[model samples]
Target: SIKLVLKMLDRQMAVIDKNIDGMLKEHFAEKLALFKDFKGVGPCMQAALMGALPELGQLTHAQIGKLVGVAPLNADSGRHKGKRITWGGRATVRTTLYMAALSAIRYNPVIKTFYERLLANGKLKKVALVACMHKMLTIMNAIVKSGIPWNPEHQNVSKNA
Candidate 1:
C-alpha cells in the first residue's frame, strides 16, 4: 500500500512537471530559448524567473538585484556601522537564485573565476556566494534585455555580472 501511494505521488508530480513545461514554453518561449545555453539556469530557476520575478528582462541590473534581494545594502547607523547585507525583496526568488548561483559557481566559468577571485581577496564563502548570485542576476538581466543567447565570448556582462 505504501509503495502504491509513493507511485501515485510520483505520477502526479510528473504530470505537474509536464504542465509547467508546457506553460513555460507557451508563454516564455523566447526567453527560454535565450536562457537555454546559460550554464546554471535549470527548471526551478526558470520557473522562478517566470513566476516569481516576471520583471526579469524589464529592469536594469541594479534594479533587478534589489528586487531579488541579492544586492548588498548598507546596514549602518551613525558611528556604529554594521555589515553590508542583502535585505528585503521576493524571498522565493531569492532562494531560487541562491541555488542557481551555487550551480554557477561550479560550472559557469565567468562566475567561477569571480568567486575564486573574491575568496583570494579574503571574502567569506557566503559573501562570495551572494556576490555570485548578484552576478548571475546581472547576466540574466543582460541576456533578456539584449535578446541574445549565452555567448561566452560576446558576453554583455561588461557591467561585470
Candidate 2:
C-alpha cells in the first residue's frame, strides 16, 4: 500500500514539473532565453528567479543581494565595529543560488578564477562561495536589466564583486 502511494506521489510530481516547464517556456520564453548563454544558471535557477525573486531586474545589485540574504550586514554601533553577518531573506532563492554558485565555481570562467583568487588570498571556502553567489546574482541582474545576453563585461557590477 505504501509503495503504491509513493509511486502515485512521484507521478503527480512529474506531471507538475512538466506543467511548470511548459508554462515557463510559453509565457516566460523571452525571460528564459536570457539565461541561455549564462553558465551555472539552469532551468531550476531560472524558475527560482522568476518565481521567488520577481523583483530581479528592477532592483539594484545591493538590493538584490539583500533580497537573497547574501549581503553581509555589519553589526556596528557608535564606536564598536562589529562583524558583518548575513541573515534573513528569501531562503528558497538563496539556497538555489548556493547550489548554482557551487556549479559556477567549477564551470564559469569568471567565477572560477574569482573563487580561486579568493582562496589564494586566504579567504575561507564558505566566504568565497558566498561572494561568488553575490557575483552571480549581480551578473544576472545586469543581464536581465539590460536585456542583453550574458557576457564577461556584465561581471563588473561593483568593485567588490
Candidate 2 lDDT over 61-153, as tens digits, reads: 999999899998999999999988888889999999999999999998899999999999999999999999999999899888999888755
TM-score of each: 0.93, 0.90
Poorest stretch of ten by lDDT in candidate 2: 151-160
Candidate 1 wrongly placed segments (more than 4 Å) = 155-161
lDDT of 2: 0.90
The prediction achieving the highest TM-score against the true structure is 1
Candidate RMSDs in Å, in order, are 2.8, 3.6
- Candidate 2 displacement at residue 37 in angstroms: 2.2
Q: lDDT tens string, model 1, 11-105?
A: 99999999999999999989989888788899999998999998988999999999999889988898988999998999998999899999999
